[model samples]
Target chain A: MNKKITKQIKELVIARLEIMPNNMKVSIGSYGAFSKDDLKRHVEDEDEIGKKVVEVQMAFLRAIKEGKLYPQE
Target chain B: MPKRMLVTLPDHDITTYYLRAWGKKAVKYAEDHSIEVTSLDRDKANRKNVESYLSNLPFGMVFLNGHGDENTVQGYNNEPIIIAGKNESKLKSTITYAISCSSAMNLGDASIKAGAICYVGYAQDFMFTLDESNSTHPLEDKLAGLFLEHTNIFMSAIAKGSSVSEAYDKAKGSLRESIMVAESSGNRTILSWLLWDYYAFVAKGDISSRL
Candidate 1:
């Protein structure tokens, strides 16, 4: 199968869900586990990870709504 | 055929926490799918470790769980940054499945610029609902099963020569469908499954040629 650019655009749409300021980097997590395989060869699980992103977005939105901050690039 | 290895990673914020949800699930799912799986917990392992592992492996799929910001993916070993570059054709080109958000956001164009097959997890963070049940099995029932479910579906789709998008949508959508139907909002079990299911993803691309 071909590596599709459409896949990234699809993820970009999801990235839009993040209402974060440009400088404010959204921190994810470090699931403590071990791997022998090279880290370079990983396929992203967008849908599942995207779910948590939505919640983070929700949090971002809540922060904005409270006038805590605003969204930037 | 080389043995399959499932590599699990951690995002930034949660990497410090000790939990088997990420690592154990990879093993269980891989076993179910006849793939040999292992995890690289945060700080304990790193890219060098992966290099060693890759050197010994025959060939298979690679699954990553961690914090994927923009162009680079943050792995363990105390913020070991893994850059996705022209190495797509390198390391025998193993297909990747990232459990972190945004790894595939630009269609993996940034990281896989050279050429690679990867399924990245993209979506809003709210999508992953943690298991709050506070019970014994934190993974066996939900996490491992969730990955296994889509993995099986993805293999089926790939066998058909389906495009990456087609296969991803097929497997992802189906995973969503099953979660919606289950709708058991009991303690941590179903809720956590529902939450996590909404986030993760499996990238499309036949990296086997590279490997």
Candidate 2:
């Protein structure tokens, strides 16, 4: 994807992550460590943030398969 | 003619926001339009309910609005899948419309294998009404006019007994952004919304029933 598209994807992933119910247990290990104030001091690229989104999404998928996210239906 | 529907909502309002919202009016509205809707919450959708519903000749339309997991679909009663004896068989072509968040993803393949005609739901997370002022996310909106708007145009075909796919396509076309499911890459959870449409896919059935 282009740089701009990747940036938008990051924003979208963040929005999806924020809505996951507590049952989904979405945690951004490193991203979580980033402080709001620190965000202003550092320049992060879309590709950098994009990695976290994939990790979180995979975590949720694995959680689902393992019966953590949404148990059997 | 009134079609019977086992309409279910969530036991808790948060996880099943779509159920909670649809219950607030969809049940009543469907009834007013002569749809024979049987409403239930998660607690009441027990074993008997699921078994009975599944065993019968398929209801023309199956409307589910609740929280779902890999092992069970939380209805007014909690119903888990029962493994029949090896030789026993199940249908693989029932049509379903799920307002549940992950019901489609968790149960999509299984439902199809078990004879579901078409399945619609959020592959990743929960679906929402247009709650524009939602405190939690910018995607939500106050969908006060949603049902009204949908019923007149989008849902008209379904109300007229058009097949599930027809109604679904009509509904989807009318609300592109609303039903799109964004496909996510196994990467960082960066701006993913633009990556996939929330209601992106429509798995169709073989040519048998017109609906």
Candidate 3:
């Protein structure tokens, strides 16, 4: 993973996760644990450590195109 | 008589805790509708016990909650309860609904081919957001509910005699509506994860089959 690309991806995913109400955490099975702090840690870590954050971010974008969210306003 | 609904609820970690909390509603709904509910909760949600229950009982539907992969549905402590090549046949003649990561990609298909009437699950990771402040009370976590309630609704629909396809449709519809609500509320952050859940959802084999 390119360090620069990893940094950019980490910032993007974390920003998205920050949309959750304060005191909430996101859990992505088989990818990362439940704590937002843990997710941030993963995103800031090396490519191998933070790959899931990038994967999930990409999946989220893909879902948007697939219209899985429906009525994408 | 209503058919039996066998549910595996494992509560060993944060992930399983949310599942267990959401499964409560499903269990209550099953019982309220006079559907026989057999639960393998906590430590009871192990491979040996699950196999024993299936072998000894007559269940029309099976609900699994745990960590899993494309080829397995696990139980307490991530023990494999139903594996693609091993005990997938035990699901023969039942409608199986798994609330686990990536099991639907392969295990769902394997179960159907091995004899299951139908299979419903996520082809990829099953994701959710929880309120850490309400972590002790997962059921009361509204953020988590935005994700888990849909899965519970699917199981509830099945227990209430809806066809497999109908339940699947109902769940997907619920997901869409939830996303809309989230969007209207300006909650864009979790929207993608919610959509990811919706996209990963899958119902295969015997779509018309019902419990």
Candidate 4:
């Protein structure tokens, strides 16, 4: 929730999005379809769409950390 | 009595264009299984038409494909069709699957309270990646299929007489399989988005209900 953590998460999200193929576009519901560059810009701006992207990234990280993404024993 | 389904396909933008194309599979599956389908497509996917059909028909299931928020799902050109506290009652006696963003957060609950048999949708943004080369032919875009295919699986399961809970479990299973594929492919973009959708997917009301 802090600004420093927020900036870090945004950087992480942008880095993850950068790996997307050039021909691929991500559609985030009504917020519209976004290219890799577009997603990076959204993360940098921290606007509504950017915030949502960050939230998603955070959720993924948490899931991994909690082993929720792993097969349950 | 034969099962009946009502679908709203609103294609006015890039996001909706893909939804409309992929949503057709569910419609087709229903018809092939002897379920009568009433398709309100494009401009016809408006509030007036949805209300008229639901109020006067015996549709047991409704598939809504479009942009939406926590309180409302839009139709063609983003015209609000079902709004929580306003038209949620129209969903009564129907199993509703809204392949839109965030409507499950509130509208799903409202519809259930209004007597809907079941409501399945995403509690957050329904995200997917599209192949721009296949933009003109969305159904051919395999990248988008990673997400939308699970939606089709859910509807198809329901048409096959699976209970709402069983259909939801099958869709979740499909998403898990895709997530494993994305992980093995080392595609962080796909993996992240698939995980997001997996967590956001929700089913409210009576999960035991069937069409």
Tell me the tens digit of each residue's lDDT in model 1 across B180-202: 44444222223333434445453
| Model 4: share of real contacts kept | 0.84
Expressed as tens digits, the lDDT of each residue in B1-211 for candidate 2 is 1265555565443334434554546556556668776665556555456556656645545556555543234455334422222101222344555554345564765666666666655464332223324424311332322222332232355555666656656655544332122112232222122222223334444423433
lDDT of each: 0.44, 0.43, 0.82, 0.89
TM-score of chain B of 3: 0.97
Candidates sorted by lDDT, best first = 4, 3, 1, 2
lDDT tens digits by residue: candidate 4, A1-73 = 2243366677788888888999999899888999999988978887778888787778888888988874321
Evaluation by lDDT, superior candidate among 2 and 4 = 4
What TM-score fits each model?
0.52, 0.53, 0.91, 0.96
Clashes in model 4: which pairs?
Answer: none
Least well predicted 10-residue stretch by lDDT in candidate 1 chain B: B126-135
* Worst 10 contiguous positions by lDDT, candidate 3 chain B: B187-196
Model 3, span B180-205: residue lDDT tens: 87789888867877877888899999
Report candidate 2's interface RMSD in Å. Answer: 12.1
Going through the candidates in order, what is the number of backbone clashes in each? 80, 68, 0, 0
Best by DockQ: 4
For candidate 2, the TM-score is 0.53
Question: For model 4 chain B, where is the 10-residue window of minimal lDDT?
Answer: B1-10
**Across residues B1-211, which tens digit of lDDT does each residue of candidate 4 receive?**
2399999999999988988998998999898888999999999999999999999998899999999999999999999999999999999999999998999999999999999988999999899989999999988888888888899999999989999999999999889888888888888778888988998899999999888
DockQ for candidate 2, C-alpha atoms: 0.07
